[model samples]
Target: MVFILDTVMCIVTTMPQTKVPLSKRERTARRLTLCLMTEEKQRRPRPSVPYGPTAKTVAEGVQKMRKRRQLTIYELSALLKKAGRPITPSAIAKIERGERRVDVDDLMALTTALGVSPAALLLPLKDSPHQSIEITGAGEVPADVAWEWASNERSLPLSSGDASEAELGYQLHSLPPGRRYLRSRPVGRAVEALRRDVDRVVEISQRSQSRHPSEFADRLAAARLSLGRLEAELARMEAEREEFDRSSREELERLRQEAARLVEEQSRGGGDDGAGVD
Candidate 1:
């Protein structure tokens, strides 16, 4: 009885531990769960505005103008798409939320879509010194006109008269220290492209007049409207170009005068030195 008991104990102690192999499905599920847990631990929330406060201000401005214009995100997106620079509703939402930074092209597109100046979206409107005021003497100012000089003032001041208040404000915002505006080259290029479109429309109008007089009557009206817009844009570009040229010329003249003065001084000093040596 003792030997049998010892043999049974030995058998129990020597017995191998049972092991179960995991099936393919179990292994996959285990891996997926581990991956999910790791991902959850690693994930972090993104900031609302990656570019900081300036970007947030711009975002707010975009939202403000959009709302003021009573435009839906989808409608704004569609307008931008029609302008050949397509943006999605989701992307506009991100911009308004300050989650995304706006690029130059998008900024221009937004300005076009929103029917507001780029300055409207860029500058802080609350701090502007200039405000719209109605003039008493205007015979009949259109509802669309935003600014009119007071009737008591005979003429607009030279400094402010050349450009609209919006343009002046944009120029001021972009001056010297920081230069927070689009380049003149891009503006010029856009104007040139638009001018080409205007030319094409003119050609169509001429052709229509000969081919179909009835069509010409309709097309002529549309052509005039297009011409008016094109001419306005062209005038703006010309004004900017003229200002640039004028400044450059003035600077050059100043430098030339400075060089002449230096030359005169040097000559005078050399003559004095020669007399002393003599």
Candidate 2:
């Protein structure tokens, strides 16, 4: 979006709007101008997203800190500036809306600016299969302790290919009372197998389609149309899922607040002591 805006601004600068109407001859002379404007409109870019646990992103860290610290957009923008970004509050707003994909560098800047560990903000949800990590306990454990645990012989079995994740869990549990870490390897193997399977399937499908076009010829264009509809449906379902999650969270928070209010009222009333004789 920024790039598109900049490009549009540049075009505007070069050809400012005119209150004067163009002559038929003049309009005909500048048909290329119309083509350029059409192209510009067609190429508008989507806004950018900040990587990590954003308020609207599917995670907790950034949202939790943003609420706990009670920071406003202006304040966040100031922090971003200090981190050398110098973007406006609106820019941050766009990022929060998940319009663009923020790369690794922006994530580092965001962590430094927000006074958080890069890991905390950037870490995916614990249950998200994208991340192959397990974290537990308190403040960032120092590198020396982690290194010591890594060097210890108790960090046994040396390879991640072992059959059981339960065994991995047990091994970690046995790691003599300090922080333990291991990256899972099975998921990588699974992903590679899936990729190979997909490639073979796609190759086979294409060959089959090419060899037997007559069978599906009536449905070929219709199949493309159906696929597009499915893609649109998937997008709609993704949006609905997000909306449902938001509604559920809002209801949960409202219930918590109501329960807290009731607790306060009960505490103030003091069961039977503060009430009239009953």
| Count of residue pairs whose backbone atoms collide, per candidate | 0, 2
Reference-based lDDT, each prediction = 0.63, 0.54
Q: Write the per-residue lDDT of candidate 1 for residues 87-112, one digit (tens) a residue.
A: 99999999998877899999999988
Top candidate on lDDT is 1
After aligning candidate 1 to the native by TM-score, how far in Å is the CA of 84 from where it should be?
0.9
TM-score of each: 0.36, 0.31
Best by TM-score: 1
Residue 100, candidate 1: how far off, in angstroms? 1.5
- Model 2 off-target regions past 4 Å? 1-64, 83-85, 124-160, 163-278
lDDT over C-alpha atoms for residue 187 of model 1: 53
Q: lDDT (0-100) at residue 266 of candidate 1?
A: 100
